[model samples]
Target: MNSFLSTSTARDLSLIFSGQGQQRPQLESILFEITIETSTCETAFADIQYVSWMQGEEEILITIGAIVRIDS
Candidate 1:
């Protein structure tokens, strides 16, 4: 994914394993730069796994799951 899509996708995924986000058993992906933007600040991440909470075959809880860059 490009930076824009990566950023948007990253924000969609707020899961941080044991962080505040709802936990899932598993979620994984490769590497890229991602940024979360808002009125006052911006955060960057890379090398993440995007995962989402899905119920049944359709309903979605959290939109995305990703690993934030350790050095970011």
Candidate 2:
């Protein structure tokens, strides 16, 4: 009797929105509004920056810093 074992290949896939040519101005506005609304009661800061290439490739970087109060 001959026995055979089959192995399966696994892959992880991710879907991302592609930037066509330039950064959308509405994106910046939306982010700013959301950050401001969430920071009303808390001392928080949100910083956003983006870099775009000539080939319509871009990356968005966001940094958020906040302080919380804890009582014991």
Best by lDDT: 1
Per-residue CA lDDT of model 2 for 1-72, tens digit only, reads 232221111111101222334468665221111223454645323232132232132222223343334333
Candidate 1, residue 51: lDDT: 51
Give the winner by TM-score: 2
User: Which residue pairs collide, candidate 2?
Assistant: none
* Model 2 weakest lDDT span, ten residues long: 6-15
lDDT by residue (27-65, candidate 1, tens digit) is 444344444344533333432333523322221222234
Model 2's TM-score against the true structure: 0.17
Kindly report which residue stretches of model 2 are placed more than 4 angstroms away from their true locations once superposed: 1-43, 50-72
Q: What's the number of clashes in each of the models? A: 3, 0
Quote the lDDT for 29 in model 1: 45
Q: Give the RMSD in angstroms, all C-alphas superposed, for model 1.
A: 11.5
